[model samples]
Target: MSYQDIRSTFKLISGGLSETIDDSPKEFVSASITDTRLMGVVSMCVHWRLPENSHLTDLHQFFYFDAEESGFETYRSVLGNGGPSEVQEINDIEDYLMGGLGGKRVILTEREVRYMLQSYVDLNLRSGLSLPEDKDEYEFMLSPRVRLTDSEEYVLMCKQCPGLDSPYQVINYFLMRCVGKDFGAAKFLTKGYVRTNLFPNHKGATLLRNVIEDSPDAVSGSNTDYHVTDDDKDFGTFNTFKSYMCESLIEYSGKFFLLITQITLDHLKIVKYEKISEFQVSAAEASMMTSRPEFITVTDLVPSAPEFDRHTTKLTSKSMVTDYENGQLFMIFQPHNDHVKNATYLLNDDVLGVYYLLEDNQLILASYNLSDIRRMELDLAESSMAPYIVPVSKYEFKDPVLFDFINSSFDDFEDFVATITKPPAE
Candidate 1:
């Protein structure tokens, strides 16, 4: 019988078996037999049991591959064997079963399977899989199981396609087989675009010329066509291992050496002067050096209070005076007030500044450079020192009290440090 006739016979048998079984949970077996020259030519048959369901119970697929046919064939068998009884065409049958059984038809050639397996191995290696750590376990987990008429033939086929030994290979083979070729084609087509646009140019020559003109003494040598070696390339420049990578012509002196930047993560700023060239290739590095100011902590400076309150701590330390001269101390000025006792003041160098902490956890830096320290000192001297002072309070000045000042003046520790130590404008 023809393939369709055989399939129809199986379907009829399945219907009859389903009717016989009714809604019972027990499995109902159905069998069909066909006799024809086409059925006799079946070289290989693979049976795969599919997921059973309420509507379609105990579904199974039987795939048949004939040596004479170009394309393989398959049929759905609901219960049992659905082929002729006296069929003797099983010699060298395993060679023809290219298409996989069941609903998921996986058709893979020997070459494709090999490539898939190799790709799996490559992926595992990339993921840092070690041979010393349960190599057999990994292989077992990754290997694909193939069902065939002959067990020996299946084993031989699997050995031939080493990729089948890895499940990674099998999965990747089907998933990436079509897309991998597309990716390769796209990479080839866009190779020129990537080379031309992706890499930024470094004007090292121009930068060197500027350096030479600015300081004639700094110019030591000139290489117009300098070729950087593979070893010289900075691959780790973007990584955390190194902050910056630089290549320059200037030689290092004991105290100073002119650095010329070529390429950086931020921008492509190159400075070249004839022979002496320096590049500020990294904007991030330059911003960090110039913008970040150095501040000194002054623990000795006294907090401002009423002058008549002689019992308050006195600023007798000469070190405080020295800090003022050096322009490093951050002094606080608290005006004599009854309503707001928590208010404080800050001195940024010679400039008098007022700061307050807001309810939103923000340290606001405002109303600075309004009054100079010299003016405030003079005003304090002229004001009444003996005012109606409040009685002995719980306020005690110490290093711990500095936190209250910081919390009131700045958002956090980092903010306070950044604000207080900010260098004066150039």
Candidate 2:
């Protein structure tokens, strides 16, 4: 049966039950299987009105049950006051509908009742597994202050959704960190956006803005689509080779290291994130770096061994950005030694691929027998997430001068180099 028909039937049955008990104040607004996350899970909500003399407002009891082959099992029962009451086990649907199986009800304000209902709709109705057809309508009703949790992928699809205005760009950035075959380096890297006022006095600024109106490019993280126009300007002396830059502080073996990553779009529209520079700095220096817009301290990373100790290091994070930028990216790299021969790897999972830096400072992005790009192309054609997957780029490692300087600055230079050079797994 359709959800509407089922809802009506449930409401009728609930009204009948309340009439038999001669309870006029108690109301059953909904008794349908509101939860769509799992096929067999159902949600039931009932409102209990206070006595005529009582000053307190009404209460709502939201009961969640799991439908099994044998019977319905009451798993969770929550009151509108934000308290979870003890679940009174109900084995049958008839018994549950006829009798109010929720053990107790707590007093709740009108705001609290509304919050409880909205929370249930946000979580259950808009689950990843059960996406509603009309997302824009639901998104419009949700408060602008609503929190965007990890599971709200459907809500993320809506243009009017809260959180980031550019949902697709945010998704594509993290898609590289998520979807993909595991070859094991850190899958996700914390990423942020930055803007530079580099060309304040450049000639023809106002005219340029007028000629090419500022349109937000779907694939770009920036509001101004200058990359689209500036890309053509690269033909002459106007070197349009621009990059997106951001910095992060990583803790390693009790020391903080400053990491700067540069992202650039290749000719094919694929986005590549290259680790441009790194420095071992004091905590004070790390804090001072945040004064600049590009640098931000990442507080949550678990400290690991220093870079060179890892056999496979993540050199870049990448994503397949489309002409109409929507969705996320997959990863690119795996260890040179572990690459399976004749195997077509899923492009989506490797957006945050690993690499190995040689003694000469040349970075080995990926190594395998299959020399053709068609191996990845073939996988992309057959995969469901093909649109989000992008081609990988061979990014050159940063200058070795900084690498040499940092190593020399180390107190135990020889010992540190020896430990770093050793092939430790990431």
lDDT of each: 0.25, 0.29
Write the residue-wise lDDT of candidate 2 on 1-426 in tens digits: 111112223221111111112222443233332322111223445545434313322333434432211112222222222222312222122233322221122233333333433554555544433323323322322454444444442332221111222322222322222111110111121222222222222211100000011123223443223333453566552343334443434332345554444444333122334444555678667444322111100011112312322212112212111110111112233222111111221211211221223332222222221332233334334544333333333322221221232234333223434565689889
By lDDT, the best candidate is 2
Model 1, position 371: C-alpha lDDT score = 36
lDDT of 1 at 346: 12
Off by over 4 Å in 1: 1-120, 123-138, 144-426
- lDDT per residue as tens, model 1, 172-243: 221111111222211212111211111123211111111111122321223222233354357532221111
